[model samples]
Target: MRVLELLEEIEEIVDTAAGFPLTGKIMVDSQELLEIVREIRAELPDEIQQAQWIKNERERIIAEARTQYEAVIEDAQKQADALVENNDITVKAKLRADELMRVTENTAKQLKIGTYDYLDSILYSFQGKMEHLSSIYFGEMFTSIEKAFDDINSALAANRDELKDMAYRTQMDADDIPAPSAESEEEDQ
Candidate 1:
């Protein structure tokens, strides 16, 4: 009876020893899982920080580009204002030139009219005197000469009877006509 009991106890001890290797394997697997979790925890914060840095750089670049664009727009507006000012100045100069030309033309026209008026006054003042002088020099002399010519033509055109009548009328005339001569009367006696 004691030998049987000792054999049974030795068999139980051998079974427990075989199960120790499985427990050791399980502990090793648990330690490997813990190490993997530690590595993930170590690397995650660095990746997140890098992502945040990239986002901040992109925002900064966008702000800088916007500032440059606004500056360019402001410069263009200034140039346009300068152009408008120059145009206004040019237009004013042109209008002034036109006004000056008009004034000059009007002055010239007035001067011409004044000169013509002066000339007309001189001519009108002298016209009547010139015509009167011409008429006095040649008027009554031309009429007397024409009458003498007409008398000579009538005497030449008379017949003998008309001449005898004219001589008898001359012998009888006193104050209304003039006698030829007293010597001619004695010769007739």
Candidate 2:
């Protein structure tokens, strides 16, 4: 489902929730919200994949650039070899070949730099959205932790090991976040 649909689902839940007497809080249906959150998680990977495809395309373009560069070099060699019998013709052929090689190399470099810049911009845009998502996701996790703290003192005394296990699992889940690159680490700071 689209993101707007997910937002709409959340809105619907909030709108239909049972209100508290004095607190400005509503009792939400956990199972329904969990299902929608899962759906949102499922959709998130698709967006990530779309961004990943730009990286893939950049590699492809680099490959094609290399191929064209090689082809140019081969053609230049063949032309120079065919005119080897005449010194002047051979000289001209070699000069033309060198010029073509230089031009192709410069073109390839520009293409690669441009591709990298384009991919970087795209990833940065996605990063902002992903950060927002992480904030929301962990915000929910923090709320759960707060609630668990509220009533779990006696229960925790009884099942301390179970609480430890739950905290461990939550930590593991949170640690599943992708690590940033050196540049992104700087950006984050």
Candidate 3:
């Protein structure tokens, strides 16, 4: 976000800079442009770190879900075993244990699905911002800056593709549960 703000400042400078008569060229302060570019470079790492944090948070949530699932399965098994020892209600105990396992599995799946959706939404927003920057600033006078934006855009596209692949793999593993639709995401927004 800070990078975007700095970009807006750069845009303002360009917009306000004086232009030559009969040419499409404009004058801008090189030092001012360099300072803002430095600021943007500094802010870029923070954005990347935030993306990394999202990924770590997703892993943590999945781990927590697995732990809870295991705990519940263990508890259900213990209860079923105790009931089996008393031969009178073995059938009922088996049925209850199965039900518990099914419910626990469904809960775990939902948790994982929710985590993936949350991460997808965040990456989607970030991808949009990167695209916006690439469209607005590319092909300007700053060749080095254009290359930097190009690299950032490429990285973002790769990240987005990776996320999509992850979600697809997860969906296939989860019995083909449908992924959230873009329309639904837009509605939520």
Candidate 4:
């Protein structure tokens, strides 16, 4: 979230920058840009940590569900064993134990299903946020930065070419100036 806000600030800076007349180039504060970029780098670890937390929480929930399932199964088995030990109502006890087992199994299945659905929803939401951030914010920011660098490189190359041309002309002009003869040098002496 802080990263998103920082990205928006960068966008605002670019949008508000003053452009060179007819050049399609804008001047930005390099210091501000660098500072915001540093902040973004700093915030990235926090985002990663949040993702790690989500994964840990999901695992914890799953473990809890498994523990509950085991506890329910154990309880159902103990009850069935106790019922079977009674020799007077063996038939009724066996039937009751079978019904209890079916109900317990169904409840365990539902609990597992519910746990999976909850984890899936959480993961789905996280995935959406990641997609939105990458596609909308990072994508546009990278494009703009790339274009700016390309413009800067073009301008620098043109300036270097102009300097080379000026240097060549200066050399040609020096060559054109005639050197004084020996007689002219003697007269000056």
Candidate 5:
């Protein structure tokens, strides 16, 4: 049933019970009410388990992306280093260092572009997966919230005896007087 309908039903029960003593068994059985609460507690672990699995998956994907990105960076650095170590083997070791430097620069630029392109594609794939999983997780979360609220309402509606017990406790608390302040005590003395 909708929330409004459920609330209206509870209100009707409360109105009907106004003609009787609040401590009577006319509303809910105390043992059964306790059982409902225990059932709710038991189901809580399942909800937590679902949340933990989603969290673990998200962390694992992020870690994998970081490892891949770092590996690509290291490989690019190694290639650039190798290019710089050339000693003009074709020129009998007589060529100017500037010639070798130009070749190394061009090779490094190409390797950088290639490495970054691969990383970008990997990042895009990771982002897509994250988005899809997040949507599914959030959808389940809302359903859980709705179910929780419904369960609470259902228990409250069926257990009028529990509500009366609470009401009496509230009345007792209100009837008891608080301790006098220091100023009031001094005035009495």
Candidate 6:
């Protein structure tokens, strides 16, 4: 499941917990909470792996660009060789070949520059997306985790206060109860 969906589910779980009377306390099942946490842990690695895959894809694109550049250079060289076959029109052939070579070299240089620019833009886009994804997801996760911990802490503090209140009430009620006097105890004996 998506991280956002998991976060929503956890929020729902917390929202659905039974609230304690007159306190910021909610009762949550430990097993259910643990299972969701386990799923989140499982999802994190897959997200990281996806980032790795994008890096690999960038490298693959660069390699393909290099291959195309080499092929263009090679094809241009072959055409130049084909144009230089005869001694009859050697001067004309040499001029045409040189022109073709210059054009081919310029085109090759342009193609290389264009390829690098395109790849750089794509990689920059991917990097931006990765940065945004990490910031958003990690920020969400940290916010959720921090909220959950805060809620738990509030619940614990409330529980402690309730226990103290109960203990005090019990002690007061015991104090109010009548006890037999020493003379009554002696007469009874």
Q: Which candidate is the best by lDDT?
A: 4
Error at 131, model 1, angstroms: 1.8
Q: List the residue pairs that clash in candidate 5.
A: none
Please identify model 1 stretches exceeding 4 Å from their true place: 1-86, 151-189
In angstroms, the error of model 5 at 64 is 0.5
Which wins on lDDT, candidate 1 or candidate 5?
5
Instruction: Estimate every model's Cα lDDT from 0 to 1.
Output: 0.49, 0.73, 0.79, 0.85, 0.53, 0.74
Sorted by TM-score, highest first, which candidate order results? 4, 2, 3, 6, 5, 1
lDDT over C-alpha atoms for residue 131 of model 3:
76
Pick the TM-score winner. Answer: 4
Deviation from native of the Cα of residue 19 in model 2, angstroms: 1.5
Worst 10 residues of 5 by lDDT: 1-10
Expressed as tens digits, the lDDT of each residue in 67-133 for candidate 3 is 9889989999999998997666888999999999999899889988988898889889978977777
**Consecutive 10-residue window with the lowest summed lDDT within model 1:** 19-28
Query: TM-score for each prediction?
Result: 0.32, 0.64, 0.63, 0.87, 0.35, 0.59
Error of 6 at 63 (Å): 2.4
Residue 77, candidate 4: C-alpha displacement in angstroms: 1.8
Model 1 agreement with the true structure over 25-66: per-residue lDDT tens digits: 111132433444355456456645655665565555556555
> Considering summed lDDT, which 10 consecutive residues are worst modelled in model 3?
138-147
User: Global lDDT for candidate 5?
Assistant: 0.53
For every candidate structure, what is the RMSD over all alpha carbons to the true structure, in angstroms? 74.2, 22.9, 30.2, 2.1, 16.0, 5.0
For residues 52-137, write the lDDT of model 5, one tens digit per residue. Answer: 66557556655665575566556555545555556554343324334444555565556556656665675566567557644754
Error of 6 at 72 (Å): 2.6
Tens digit of lDDT per residue, candidate 2, span 109-173?
Answer: 88778878887887888788778866875465546535534434544465788888899999999
Q: Give the TM-score of candidate 1.
A: 0.32
Error of 3 at 175 (Å): 91
Q: Where does candidate 3 stray beyond 4 Å?
A: 137-189
